[model samples]
Target: MRQKDNGGHVRQEDGNVNNSPPPTLPNLPSRRTPNFPSDPLQILRPDSSESRRAQLSEPSRGRKGASLAAVAMTKPQQQSPPSTTATTTTSPPPPPSTPPPASSSSSLAKLPLRLHSLASSSRSLLAALRRSPVTTLVAAFFLLALFMYGEDVRTLAELSIDDYLYPDADFYNVSALPPLLLPPPTCDLSRGRWVFDNTSLPAYREKECTFLTKQVSCLANGRPDDLWQYWRWQPNNCSLPTFDARRFMEKMRGKRMMFVGDSLNRNQWESLVCLVQPILSKGRKKIVKRGSFNIFYAKEYRATLEFYWAPFLVESNSDNPNFHHIDQRIISPERIESHAKNWKDVDYLIFNTYIWWMNNEDIKVRRPNSTSWSEHDEMPRIETYGRVFKTWSTWLEQNVDPASTSVFFMTISPLHNSPAQWGNPNGIKCVKETLPVLNYTKPLDLNHDMRMYDLVAKVAKNMKNVPVSLIDITRMSDYRKDAHTSLYSIRQGKLLTPEQKADPQKYADCIHWCLPGVPDVWNQILYTRILSKSSPPSPHPPLPPQ
Candidate 1:
């Protein structure tokens, strides 16, 4: 509201229209605004509607008639003694010294009446809001946040299944590339719910996976739960085929399929190895681990399924699979060649990198040519991520042969470190958990989520020739908070014992998925994609050249 100055020039109440709409006022949004508002999302969004509403709410806008609340704001309170019963004569109020000439316009006459009604309504709303004075100036912020998230989600709706899988940056110019090795956009496999099918055994028994690392072997580690292993991800519209180990091996006869990322990918790699291990005899297959590479070779088919530990997917000190410290994390984003040379020519390439890069502070990065390993520059996370992908995308354009190679990006595997995510405020991280989150409709995620899918999707879109299909296993995996290798898993290369399991907070491994569990479903989805189109013959006649 404006007041007349001694010199008669009006000044703004707040010379500060706060730069970003001063934190939303206590839910100023009232849909029951029949007597006042007609604009949409007005209280939150400081556009023309809000500006116009503010004008009507101001007492100065209607000098002829001030609202009840407006008069209270302008006046000060003073305590006085109770009035005595005494008759007193009152003088008539004086008129203004210089009254304005009367106007004949109906708009001027009717304006104050409308403003009075709106001002009263605004005062009533403000009074209700003032009862609970919070930091927020408006309640519409929650609505705005939902609207934004809703908008961000629908951006993908423009994309087809092929586009979702194999994003062509130039959505208009897709014909330049060869045919994508994905099924037509019929039913979205990513948008699905989990099903309980304890009717049969899981893809593989825990005891039979001889090569399964003890880190992910929860059942063998002596945990008491098994319901996490029985659930299968079922697509809402389409019936996915069961994983056939023999058929999958047959398709990759003389080729290589590698899972290249962090331990989560290693978790998937172990799941895949276990899935197909039963088909071959012991002598026919063997797993070899040397430095960062873990290979499981099939003697008969000459096929290899491997897992490479490149958490950052670039040159980094943490590349060594055996030993790496979380605190002393470092990377050379522009130099991926050290690790790229290993899995560059693989027939089926599955990639994932997220959890390792999620640090609260800036990341330490070194230049590729630096001789002194001690010298480093601290770079922000997202910037470093962008540079790493830029190098990776450049490498893909130069090295990968789209005709022979089918590239895949496994989406970020979700972690269940917070019990509050699943509506259990009292529970610990993935410990004593039995079943997968059954209710898909419930808000089982954190209010403040850190999803890197957008960045991954953006990077995939910018690729020119290479068609990297996204095996969108994030949302589906998010429901499996029960599937993580919690306290039942390993710590520092050894499994946790009974006494150690008692303290879940210090020992829980929520980042990695337990075998015969979530990763099996990931493989099921991967298997679905694998069966869609047969792989082309390996360009290098017998895979890794003799």
Candidate 2:
């Protein structure tokens, strides 16, 4: 029998129909498949509608088939409908056995789920916070404190003596320890003798140091008392810790220490330099002089030791280094800023001004607004001293930060110009004395001018904020009558003539103490005071076992 083909072509309806395939339909170019292959396998494949229909209808597929179906569900197929069919048919797809690979649409579909999960977590956290608000605030505060003080806490855990030395009760309130247990600094320690020991002779040789004033260089001027070179200050009650120059430099690293006062302070300043300079290597030290200010820099430590010559400790006409007249000294009692402006930002300040005030019988003070000088005649020296100290104290209270600065007031350095004051009628001055007054029992009578000692002590005691230490070198220094420069002091770097040297009473320098002498002991006391004020780390408590 003959049968008509779907394309209206003649075809025999026999078993050979399977062997000879029907003619292929013309393939219109599709957007998805622009270059469709004309291969027989591609043409023989089932249409998308039929394939999806088979997958939907067959419910008992094996594991392999299910996996294949899952892959097919994930990858969408592209199709082009035949022109003969007016409408295309599509079967509903089966539910995916496994989720599709991540894509923009898939990610968007999961966004709502993620948002719901986040909202649930946030609600739980809020509920927890509401239940324990105090706990939450405390935890936050603890975290903040830890962030701020973490390093300081760690440092306190591992403190060493090399790092710092603890302060005593004199500097601050040490209420933790009982009064009996505290080691108070004794006055007997300050009143000891200078014993002969070649091992600890001169800190720096006078011949080598160029910083020494010609007036104080007794060793260079051929003094016969080599015993003075070997003599060391020995405190009666407590031993003074030998000054460690390296340790001192380390402590003073990147700091500015200044001596603000008269040439007496300059004497102590030179002594400190001699004490520390022996440790400095070549090219490690430098000296800079500008007008009345002299600065010595230790390059390795970045430390500066400066001296500003302000004899009155306030503004004075005698402030000039070269033009300061001994008898014509003029002071402006309130005008301190002209001198104090340079003293700002100092880490340590050592001040002395008692000797200059004693030069004139009447103080020539310039009034605040007037050009004429007013004489403060026979004004009890203590009252005059008190006014000046009040001005200084006011300046300190206003300008100095107690947390950053350490201040010291050296007590009056006694002068031995009159040997009659110390009960030696035969000797006119300190010219021929070879040894210190060893067994002096009577306290020498220092009159009203020396009453400034009690005033300074009272002022320091009364101060509540800034603690100024009074270095009382007077009593101990009074015993060292043999330590002065005397006739050995140079006059303009020239040896005294026989005529001038004969008059030891006139040419004797009983004012300044000799270097490698009593000034060293003064510096030692200064060192101890400095160490006593430093708030070093305490011993940490034992940690509890985990």
Candidate 3:
């Protein structure tokens, strides 16, 4: 086990600069092997300077199809193959702060779609057709088929099919099925359980309207701009009617709240800090990192907000050169609990690990025992992961004292990469398409992509008082479609082009939400859930300086 200083931090090796550099922590390259675009918003372009009245006032094509076709005709030409050198983008640092617009969800929903068309020469197609029309058509057909298949796959996957199909699928070999958590004994108190303003908050800036559920708002206090006062200014009712931050701190003061996972989890951590920072004086709330974990402590409350980067949460370092070339495994279950052995002292624990596991090489996605990737056999067969998590769950059941400690497992954050949903399939990740939480009653199976759901549910059933709560952020995020950082992260200097500044969606981030962005909603949900039971210590009534 790594040794820790009395302060609860582990010291790092001197020469390990890149891996152990000071905390605090993008770019799309053109050439340089055509790297992935860091800014997801730039992929789609919606006209901002022009007025909707002007376009409609002087209508060119009577039919919507004709107008769309005309817009397509004016699309920019894709850059040709580079002669030798490559091109890349360096996204600028984030802006200091900004004011959000005042618009209700309904008005935001009526926004128009941002459309872009690529101009390909007929000659280019003819030459390729002459060479292999059949091949080109066949490839196109295959792609179309795949998308069609994906749609069906997504539909089937989203449904509540866990019971019927996997009746005997013991999430953990030790556990059977878990009971269904009905929406809440009834709708009144149920609605009050975790309800925020009961309306969505607007995006920090204007972005595209595509892929967004027309009227959804980003959850209030979910963004930096929305909650900066609460964090710094120490405002009351920061989590009013639903969550009461002061009450939460009173309950959790001197206790701990640990969010374990990858960077996405960190995003939520930062959001939470921003939400609560204002409660304390400058330097009173400090963030310090020592070894494998990082902690943010509010001295007034004696609460430490900690983060442990255990994407896999189990030890799986690269023993092989190939694995090292990809990602080094870091945890071993046998040795895993050692890092978090102190977790027993924690008052609350929240965990997540999904996107990191999506990569093919990370773990043996397709087992050696399986011949091919089939829809039927596509159930994640990470035998080793299954065993490790099972052990982890069993560990939690044994370790945590339900009376004092609460545990939560956040759902997989969704990825919006498709063209039909976001309009800028080639350009953005999850940029400006901010909308409200969708109200679809459609049952979508979260099995295929989120293989951990079943395992977690099964684990929950077996654990006695832990009452593993599911922070279902997936379905809600899937609909936001536009609320990612996308291309904004790639802009290099503080200053940006008029086009860049005007197009908030193009410049915003995709992979992770901004400080006052979407993740704050997750933290708010967490706050509501944890505080409902007990009141945490307040940061007020300042204690002597540490």
Scored by lDDT, the top model is 1
Could you tell me the TM-score of candidate 3? Answer: 0.48
Q: lDDT of each prediction vs. the true structure?
A: 0.66, 0.62, 0.46
Candidate 1 per-residue lDDT, tens place, 1-546, comes to 221111111111112221221122232232221121121111111123344334334433232213322322343322222335423446564232222233222123344555676799878876787776561346567557768775433332221111111111121233453543443558788777888988754878988777777777788888787888888777878766677776677777767888999878888988998998787643446676656777776645656788887899988877667666667788888888888887666789999888877765478998658985477889888778878888888888899998889899988778788888787889988788888887668545642224357777887888889988888887788888888888877666566777887788877877788789888888888988877865576665443210
Clashing pairs in 1: 24-136, 24-137, 24-138, 25-137, 25-138, 26-137, 27-138, 27-139
Candidates 1 and 2 compared: the better one by TM-score is 1
How far in Å is the alpha carbon of 293 misplaced in model 1? 1.1
RMSD of each: 30.8, 35.1, 27.4
TM-score of each: 0.64, 0.62, 0.48
**Candidate 3 global Cα RMSD:** 27.4
**Candidates 1 and 3, the one with greater lDDT:** 1
Query: Which regions in candidate 1 have their CA more than 4 angstroms from the true location?
Result: 1-184, 367-369, 447-451, 543-546
Tell me the tens digit of each residue's lDDT in model 2 across 479-545. Answer: 7788888777665446667788898877777777677778887887787677656633222221110
Shift in Å, residue 495, candidate 2:
4.5
Number of the top candidate by TM-score?
Answer: 1
Q: Per-residue error at 121 for model 2, in Å?
A: 70
